[model samples]
Target: MPQRERKLRGHFSTPPLLVEQVLDACGYTPDKDLSGIRVLDPACGSGNFLAAASRRLLSYGKQVGLSARTLARYTHHNIWGFDPDPIACMLAELQMHATFNSCYPRSQALHRLHIHQADGLAFPWQQCKHVDLFLANPPYLAAKNNDLSGYRSTHLRGQVDSYLLFLNMALQVVRPGGWIGLVLPDPVLARSNATQERQRLLAETTIHHIWHLADVFAAYVGAVVIIAQKTPPHTHHQINWRRERWIDAVPAQAADKVSLPLQMVTTVSQDLLSQQPGAELRYLLSTIKGTIIERLQRQLHMQGNSQTPRTLACLGEYVLIRRGEELGKESALLKSSAPQPNELKWYPVLRGGIDIHPYAIPTASCWIAREQIVKPLDRYLAPKILLVKSAGRLQATLDTQGHVVLQTLYMLQLSANPTSQPETQALFSAEDELYFLMALLNSRILQDYLYALHTAYKWVQPQIEQHVLAQLPVPAQAAYTEKEQIIDRAKLLMHACSKSSSVVELKAQSYELYEEQERAICALYEIALQQRRVPDPPHDVVDEGVSLYG
Candidate 1:
């Protein structure tokens, strides 16, 4: 019979700065606050944080005039740790002993620590119900082994991700009004749709700090540490409450002192929105859509079957694809099933999806083209923005081509105005329409909004059908012209960048020519494309987590 192997888990040491910052935020100082600080490390692993906390508390106790023996006893009893790995629990205990002995060399009880081998997420909460501070880098394990209930569901419930589940469990173990600090992937904060519990957990607590540590994890994935204090309001209690705000981390400032009232913490991206109240421009566009849609309906009724301009594309439209569906031995072409002919002048050939972060174009043969094509304005069809609705974490790449290669994705084609309708001319300049369309896709605000909505609704396996696409709020073109110009210039910059044979050779030139506006867009897309979760804190300070920590 084969021997059983231990479960593989992501267990690593917490960075030293993280430990100090978390402790400081919780008012647990080595000498000032450690004597009575009741701390727990839920996913203790090798007790990296536990060992560090023990050292700090021991030092604090000694400085506060506690005897060496008393300090040892307090260190063993005051701090608690739990881990699912028996070996890890033993290792953590050993580490505590080593750190404890260093503080109290003559003490005998220092060798026995309170670290235990048990699933942190599964431990009976009554065991550590009074835990004042919960600080941990929990073992990230997919809830497996028929052990998915208990604390996992109690905290996470509908959340499919284990990291999120662990976060909830950690919060549950911490006493009310106590502090909880944790390191987790960036998405939980920004991804539009976090499980209800995640949003509720954040909304419930007073977040103190958030730190965006670029390339901190070996996964080289961006990470943030959230320090929170649980202080929810009672139904009838007269308590002043506010939503959480994000802060950027600055090295010089003390981590414990970071707090801003929730009312003042509106998302910076909201300010970037194109629609400002009382802007005449939006009213004009609103009037135009109403006029155009109404005019087109009448014209379509009159024209009957004639091919009046039925396609309405947002300006700056990038690629139009000729779709051909081919299985194994079938023709390798995605032939369009639309009533428009292969020679349809309105819909041009576009090939999308080949690393167009900042900029992209279709491969030579990949461009969808009918045999007959001539002149830019002759074709009336416009390419629609269609994203590959997949569950994968990879940054959704640009499908410069109009056709979607991925299965189950939606194809968006603009609804054309009837040839008789004069409103089409007033909607936007032809070139401007395409430009506007591309700008919307490239906008970070729109992307984030889409991402949030996607996350919130992704679990439903939403069919990205026409109704869904239609529901997407369209920003006013005139309101976003400045942003559009930046995107257009970036697109041009990227087009120029494609001239280079390699990224290495062109990187410096790319930076030198790129302005701040373009660079911001590039940085955001690159970060988003790589699935980095670091929240954009507009201020110079780094946010360790949600700013609800007290």
Candidate 2:
């Protein structure tokens, strides 16, 4: 299929080995009885799961002394599949025929297989009930791009993927005791957009296992395989979550070896997941790290204020925040080499995240013509803070040169009305306030808080949102003596960082100073950090072998 069509339809074929894994997860063992077992693949692309399931049932039938004709009849009647593509349905039917011939040769009876071309989401549920297993890799379309009006409900809203809707529909059609094994995108479990659906899934089903598969498909999209049962919500049940690294290429032979190295991250209880507002199953954090981080947040919430500790003034309250302007296709404005004349029109431009750091920018390689600069040109000439919008940590630096910055950076300037109270102006000058804010923004405590709240993976590329930045707690009317000391220390730290020889040395020196400042800030905020062991970094394993089934 063409790439464009595949994207529009969200059609990606499952590898045979992965199909076998899903079947195994659904409890389709060859030793078990094959009679009266009904399997349905809602989005059965080319019938991979159906083909695998049919072989398993036939193998079980042979073990139980069933004749070839009877086994073929049972296979045709028991297994059900649905796909929107007629060609895929035909291909799936062909696969089933091949499976029947391989398992039960010389069976003259024509098998009436239940594979049809139709939208699984719109399939009439009244026609089928008591399904034993529902296995699928449903279409992956965003809600806005596709016609999902039939599937839309309160639980499914706001850019929810089509696979999630398929999962929900499967739950409704499957019997109470039946199982659902699906391969879905990872965001379904973690993204805030899927909060309602996640909550519904947790409340309705008992999740047996979840495996995070990194780069499992040809497109290298992050995915997860969830094996869950349609059971009444059981708060005490523990869900197993594991991470696996699969080899990139499928094995050539059925007997070939494939490495599926697995790591047990943590098992979470349904009660805890249900209690969370989003019901976010964030298993990325290890047991010790999660516990300690939660404790710190709770302490900050309880002890930081007498009445409402959760409420804190955002950074925006004290500064004007604006994103850098994008210089579109105006090649004349930017020069590869220095201008021949050092005119006022040529100003240094900071164009990327690499040029930004904690307290200083290391380099400015490009210069822009000031005449072509976007609106608010005065912002480029003011003493302000520059923050890299797309960095894992808060990459903020003091830009005193009035350098023009590209869209990758955000500019922060002190608000025009610095203080509403005239008496408070004497306590801290604007420069002193900028230094203090820089110190807090670059602190390890604030970094930890942002990471815990916004990221799901250890090595996340977090984009600092304006609203999130504004929530930083500011000291309310501090003593002049302590405020002056903090400002002095911040100034020294900034100077030392700018003078450092290399990035590594600058980070080390900056961290040492940040820790010292954090202690004083913690005292002012009345927050305490508990001593705990930091968890080991997550393991990244690579294994080269043949497929598990092969």
Best by TM-score: 2
**Candidate 1 lowest-lDDT run of ten:** 277-286
Give lDDT per model, in order.
0.47, 0.68
lDDT of 1 at 225: 70
Query: Which candidate's lDDT is highest?
Result: 2
What lDDT would candidate 2 get against the real structure? Answer: 0.68
Candidate 1: clashing residue pairs, number:
53
lDDT by residue for model 2 over 1-550, one digit each (tens)? 9877776777888777777766666777787776788898989989988988888888888888888878878887889899888999999999999888876567766458899998777756765668888898987777777766666462434666687777777777788888888988766766677777778778888887787776566442566788888886564576778777654356523512453346555576655566554677655433423343444444434443445323233466678888887863235677756766747578788775767777764467778776668767888888888887776567677777888888878788889875322234366777777777777677666776666555433223446777657655455445566667777877877766753442323556566665677787665444223222222223321011111101
- The RMSD (Cα, Å) of candidate 1 is 13.6
* Clash pairs detected, candidate 2: 254-550, 255-550, 256-550, 257-546, 258-546, 314-470, 315-470
TM-score of each: 0.56, 0.77
Per-residue lDDT of 1-550 in model 1, one digit per residue for the tens?
Answer: 1112222455556655556666766667764766777888878877778877887787677777888778777877788888777878888888888887776677786645688887666556656557788887764445443344555354434434557666767666677788888877545543333345455554466655544444444442345576768875232221121222223343322433444312322221111112122111011121222222223222323333446432222221323422222222123443434435545432323322221233344222332334323323222233444343432211122334443232333333333542222222354454444444444444444444343333322222223333323433332223244445554664555455453232212256565544554354444333322231223333422221111100
